[model samples]
Target: MPVTDVTTDPEQLTMTLTAEFEASVDRLWQVFSDPRQLERFWGPPTWPATFTSFDARPGGHAEYHMTGPKGERSSGRWEFLSIEAPRRFEVIDSFMGDDGAPLEGFPSMRMTFEFEADGSRARLRNTTYFDSAEALEQVVAMGAVEGSTTAMNQLDRVLTGLREYAQGKGTRVEELSDTLVRITRLIDGPRDLVWQAHNDPELMRQWMLGPDGWTMTACEPSQTVGDSYRYAWAPLEGTEGESFGFEGEVLVVDPPRRVVTTERMAGTDGPSTINDSVFEEEDGATLVILHIEYPDRETRDMILATGMAEGMEASYARLETVLAE
Candidate 1:
């Protein structure tokens, strides 16, 4: 187990757990900043977590549920209180009901995580403060210690696998659930430049073209929430493909960090998909992680069957060239 020690103070109504890892402090921080990585080890062995929404910033909130082997689910929410990149973060953690509200009679706690470099490795100090001793005791009795220990132990595999999983992979797709899919690509550029390439019409027109022999004919991008944007593409002369386009309304925008939008094919009344894209910088490269929620399983499968991942890879490869220029 990575947990080196676990201590509790009844008088202070607090519990603290210390753990060490063979990864750098920055690498350790990525696991928390990226929801995809956070879900990998946030729950115990038999109960795996799935984060439907994660916004890792002060005042932002995250919602997740851990599903047990028997299909039972335990939902939770986190209200980010403070954050200091590669160092520390704090959140108000609460049990959530199926209706997405805090569960009554459940005690919420203020949890803080601190990370630091310890010689060649990294160390994490996680502390949880309860409202009272009773609250602390209640969680302990609910197997909090054991569950947390097992969860942290699973982090080793995740930390070790991240680099090999994404470093050179052009564009990777993962089916997070029946309706949700995640696509990630590490672009060789800074976060701000990558964000500009996505939002700036001229820059977008340069690289958003999915495959060779295709041109972006129209690029109307939405810059504000509630506003709609449209993009159209056409095959170059003699190329075999039909012209098509997509339209979407922007729901949320945090410049150079995250954006949420609802997308659907233009000129069609098909069900729309919610797309949440996040940008994070690691070692000077920006990683683009997109979570796409389709209306149903059929829609998700149909989109994937259309060779979406392959097309995205081609676009991303072109994006790198644009960035280099």
Candidate 2:
């Protein structure tokens, strides 16, 4: 709606819009718990005023009435297709005639929402599915596709505002999968600066937040194939330290070309849920690749949809600034 580029393939139509909220994901979740908040943004300006009878539960109803631009009112019922509490919600939306009349032709859509987070970053992805290609084509023709995207973009803005409003909130990410997120930066400085920034705790403290305001407490090399160490975090003063351990066999540590740590960040050690970081030279700069491999499939999908990328990007900016200072 705001002239954003739309990229489509045979499988999906991808429209990405970003907003940086100072509030955490946990705070954002509360804002969506109410139906009133939802309808305020879900309606189009041309659609006449509306109200919703929402049962925000599994197998419940989310019914509403809409006044068209021409003053024609229409009614519809949406049944909750699936739900995973505060993390995910899926619904089957069906349109009907003005009264309790028989159904007309409108694609039945399965809409889903997924939540993910990094230290201070959070991502939420909404995906909807149509039964078939003809169904999709029909909706596109009726302008439903574009209209829905507009609604989702509005929803994004609402969530972002909620997040920024509650800055006192601490970071608590519900990652569906292992590590669930990655951290990487496109550094313009020389190789030494990039490498040192990653390895130095002070530089990391400028960006990566551990648990509560905790920074990296300790990191040591037990280096070799199948060797690793533990890092501790103390977010608040007078709190006991929390430690997470990693033991990884070196896959590659060829200096500037790349460095790989089989280190797992979300689950028990071993190759189970490993994180790999790679650095490559690009015009005297470095293109860093940060990847997290999780053991679960569902978690993987949820994590990818969450706003991890944007969070990582922001931290990278901080890292560069810290190095320059």
Candidate 3:
């Protein structure tokens, strides 16, 4: 992770975060200056930020909202106070309501972001000054530390090109928290084709099989929000394992880009997980990121212990072959 330290001081009424990156100071500055790039890692994986409006100059302000898995949104705005190219910038950050006004009863904070060169690397120091200790404590109690850490750690991937960062990495899984896991893989195909492969039954049957001995017996994919999908697999005649399946309801579908669903074991009363899958295309290839939020820590552990990552990797490898064909 890029984030190194996070500290809060009651006496000073401030919180500070320090992170180091392998990129140069100029590169680090560009990421913050560009709203598109900034939104990519400004929020945690579960709630990704979308910048509705961004003006980077001093005296300018930016409006953005982070959307949660269940389609809930939390809006925020930043008023740029000062800007020093490739070095530092300052802003006043405030919570906003749906009417585009700063929300009442919410404390606004002054934030300063400083970038410095560190001999072929860069260091970022972000300090937020609050009006009172109560305000500082409030944000901390709201999981600010963990949220900021996870948000900053994502900068590493944003800083690198998609292909350079994900290609050849195969299917990688990261346990973000007790109940959240992230799975990522690079598909050697366009985003549209990759999306089609997931939604088309004929295409899915070609590669969605977890292991060589298993065959997809049924695939009913959801095409719209509120629709339910079911997939079942059974071992080949000579194979050993019994039949199993999964069912899920589509919650959100932004074709070729993102899809959110609630997934559970087909016939069981097991807890369901919210799966948010995002696809981004770069250089004729697609990067697939799946963020799964389990119902509990035990559920997360049990699912991961079933060699889920390895199974997904096998399926993804097969998808690459299918795409080539």
Best TM-score goes to which candidate?
A: 3
Q: What digit string (tens of lDDT, one per residue) describes model 2 on residues 267-287?
A: 453335455554544345555
Query: What lDDT does each candidate get?
Result: 0.86, 0.54, 0.91
In candidate 3, stretches whose alpha carbon ends up further than 4 angstroms from where it belongs are none
Tell me the tens digit of each residue's lDDT in model 3 across 235-264: 998998999999988887778777899999
Per lDDT, the best of the predicted structures is 3
Backbone clashes in model 1, listed as residue pairs? none
Name model 1 segments beyond 4 Å from true. 1-106, 110-165
Ranking by TM-score: 3, 1, 2
- The digit string of per-residue lDDT tens for model 1 on 1-325 reads 5889988899888899999999999999999999988986798754667799998889999999986533468999999999999899999999999998899988999999999999989999999999988899999998998888878976875787644547787788878669878788988888999999999999999899998999998899986888999999999998998999999888767687667788899998878998877676756788787878899999999999998898899999999999999
Better candidate by lDDT, 1 or 3: 3
